[model samples]
Target chain A: MKIKKNIAISQSGFAFDPNSGDSFSLNPIATEIVNLLKDDKDEQFITSHILEKYEIDEFTFQRNFDDFVQMLKHYQFVE
Target chain B: MLPTYNIAITGLNNTDNPGPGVPVIRGLREAKSFKVNIIGLAYENLEPGIYLDGICDKVYQIPYPSAGSTAFIDRIKYIHEKENLDFIIPNFDAELFTFITSQDILSDLGIKTFLPTLEQFEERQKVNLPEYGKKYNVQVPNSKALTSLSEINDLRKEFDYPLLVKGKFYDAYLAYNPEQVINHFNKISAKWGLPVIVQAFAKGTEVNVIALGDGNGNTIGAVPMRKQYITDKGKAWGGITLGDEKLLELTRNIIKQTKWRGGMELEMIKTNTGEYFLIEINPRIPAWVYLANGAGQNLPEAMVNLGLGKEVIPYTSYEIGKMFVRYSQDLIVDLSIFEKLSMNGEL
Candidate 1:
């Protein structure tokens, strides 16, 4: 999955949608996920990378990943 | 030599229902006697002043007052450690009580605030307007507070058709009948809580005055404005300064009687018979305060000087006929500013 190219995401986890004038604050890890998604990383790659960095189980990581990505879709941040 | 100060200001939302933060900042930034570095205490991420350049040197999001005083003070303390705030100016009515109550604690931390005494604050409340007018010997229309929906029916007996139904903090609707009164009562009460105020509609042109008090019964400055045009939201879209002797006398008398401290906006209606009826008394500076600065009396600068414990002289006159027309602009802010403010809580 990929985030919209026009979405401006900052290092501090602040994401602004220029088209909609909507802004959002993401957790640090969620910020990393947005960066990776901007680079066109797949879910498997994202889950694997985060699992190694954070002390989370594969099942838990998968569940949170699915939920967060679903949220990105819900907010129309992902394409 | 001018002393440098790091001051914190709140109520940065310069939306259609604008706050006084940006206008106050503009006035202070233009001060001739002192140099100021403004630290904006913002409640929301989207407050226009947070992103507006040349207004606030930095912005930090603070918790809503409903989140409790502890959280609010904690954030201020943290900002104080980082910014070393000399003083604070709170502009929203919703947060005044919390700030006023915390003045002692802030003083202990070396941050000063000039605000109204709790006694003065309670006297001018919308629910207490009639008593305030009576006590101060000013002319005000009959207004009563409604705590229940059933009271709307009772209001009709004293107030005729087309009465004003208002909330405790904001919003006022002119209701012509029982149906509109109930509608506004439900709408206002649901938003601003109970004790809806129904006022007898006074037929007149609306006029407002922005005045500052020196805490000891002296008016530091006062500027009266007549709204030339008003938007649908009832804000002055265009207004002109007036040289009215009676209005100025009334303002001075009220300030002298109350011994009011800090900034206040007096809303009044001028009847066709040349009588002025008091309406609302906003405790903080109004959004249109920049007009005062344009007219020659820099009230915010005076308030800052007072908060800094410096002696200031009262401004006796201002240039009349100066007009102010409000306009909107869009600012293109970089993502890095937003990032620093959101991620690090500083920008």
Candidate 2:
């Protein structure tokens, strides 16, 4: 549930994992989530932030967030 | 003023399983210290580098290593007399033995070459992987060489199912059973000669390191890469430079212990448990060597400097996260160019 400290995300939503040398292009939502995670924000804070900023309901945000986090885990971006 | 050296290189076949020649030339062309007149020493007339404009100033069809050193060196002598060559870089694996043995004769002719010594060359061969691993303190899979089919039945005792059947110089197949092993053995042996290697299968992700050793136990340059895309021939179609310190440390250790000279590619597999096993050590610059250049370490340039007996400071760093994706394009050429190379042996 914790993002690796060395992950570098650019303004263009390009994410680079310096440790594994893997690069990824994140969408706006994913980029925001990663930025929030970098700032030590908890999942509850991220959920509320997304719900308040976007038109999506709480349940949809939670589901998408879970899926996104799973992908981050699969790519070894998060520990 | 930068001195221009006449350098000859081989293995210009830029096919699916590409050779290091084209990329190496690209590095040399971009060299900061000197300019070059590239001589293309090709075994076949149609090798892509021979046809590529501006890559080779002149191209000559040379005899294969199978022709033995006398004929090989004689052709080189002929080329040297005409070109006044300063250095030669032979890129193919099958030709390394001839080059290593002829190092002294080439040196006597004032043609400098940075190559591993014959002992260094022989000890890191695929057939000697086990001993090489032990001597160099690296982890290598248990492997046995089979000269005949009679040895196949006994392989099961030492290795489990889905082991690797490998040729001496090239090609490898995963054999699930004895029948497949025999098939691969016959196929590989027919192509690459006797003593096909049977190695225990190590399941993991394949990673590679392109390294240059200074023959004095110093690593001139090293860059680790992971294959982002693999062709059916098991060649890296695309790869990226990595920031993995462990792989770099391992490369430095091997270069230090072996006092390995010249360009080498270390093919390794990183198991899920985070252990790295040395799979194969290719004794020349890899086809993807341009990646090293793009990542900030121009190893081919360093190699030329070393060949010329110039002092070269070891490259301290390369930009990680740099990726190289390969592509193919058709080149339009006239019939006369091919005719000239085929008929006159030089163009």
Candidate 3:
């Protein structure tokens, strides 16, 4: 899945979709993931980065990451 | 130097179900091209806007529309004599008929008003929605106007169980069965008089567009909003501007077809399948008009310019994603101000 290019996520985790005019607030981890996605980072890289910085195991990170990605899709933040 | 105009406005009742007066005034106060000295025309002594600081330079109590055109015009003339009013904006639906019909008299008195023509106003009434839809080639849910109790039995032939029982001027209730329809019919007719309208319930998300039309078939401004929080009265407590091109295009088309003058709010239902059904068209500015100003289209200011016979260029863009959340606050007022307005009809 690819995040839409026009979605602007501020450093404070305020996400705005210019096309739909919908706004969202993301938690820090979600914000980091979105920033990584914005920089064209692959899901594997994002997962490793999250796995490295946090206490969670790889399996739990993968499950949570999948759920987060699903949420982004539901909000039409990703294509 | 920006010109300063003396403008009078009505509908100052800023309650739960707000009149557009306060927000419209807020927009006019923020106008960049011109300055305004606001004269508030109120029907009651205690309208919140009358007490609000810096909203109106002077507040004059005017006769309600129930008092005929003669009394209405007489009061307006009295106020105009004092204020030398350049323009008047009547914001209530009940009062619009009086103002629209008396446009010539107001103009003769050097008081300009930008309002829809009587024909435009009458044709878009809730009772005439079906015909308005047909004439304008817009999608409208099936509806029938009933003048008696017996008509409720016949509703099943056309509409489903869940339908809307609506009053002529205001109020709408969703009735789930024949008994509920009869109940609402009596309640609404008792309040707003005959020919209650029963409309098929269009299942969808309710979206609204606040728009302004210049008399010459041009849309000066149009902004679509989706209600984020809805009050029990069906008014939006919070709404966010949307970038829905289809909705904006529909608004523009309606304005072009009707050559609608003045400010209007289009209430519509956008279904999941992407079809839009025109529901109600309010012929005056809505209470949430400040959202348009916040989104970069100062419709009220544009409307004031249009009222002065100025050539206003249509607004081409507005920042999307702007949101308006309504809040209430208490204002301390001296009893003498209220007493003066009550006794002398001016404050």
Q: Top DockQ: which candidate number?
A: 2
What lDDT would candidate 2 get against the real structure? 0.92
The CAPRI class of candidate 3 is medium
Writing each residue's lDDT as its tens digit, candidate 1 over B32-76 gives: 999999999998888999988799998899998999999999999
Q: How close is candidate 1 to the true structure, as a TM-score?
A: 0.80
Q: Given the true complex, what DockQ would model 3 score?
A: 0.49
Candidates in order have lDDT scores of 0.90, 0.92, 0.91
Q: For each model in turn, which proportion of the native inter-chain contacts is also found? A: 0.00, 0.78, 0.61
DockQ, each predicted model: 0.01, 0.70, 0.49
**Residue B90, candidate 2: how far off, in angstroms?**
0.6
Q: With candidate 3 superimposed using the best TM-score fit, by how many Å does residue A3's alpha carbon deviate from the native?
A: 3.6
Error of 2 at A16 (Å): 2.6
Q: Write the per-residue lDDT of candidate 2 for residues B61-137, one digit (tens) a residue.
A: 99989988899989999999999999999999999999989999999999999999899988888889999999878
B44, model 2: CA deviation in Å?
A: 0.7
Winner by lDDT? 2
Q: Worst lDDT window (10 residues) for model 1 chain B?
A: B148-157
Give the residue spans of candidate 1 off by over 4 A: A1-79
Model 2: residues with Cα > 4 Å off, grouped in runs: A54-64
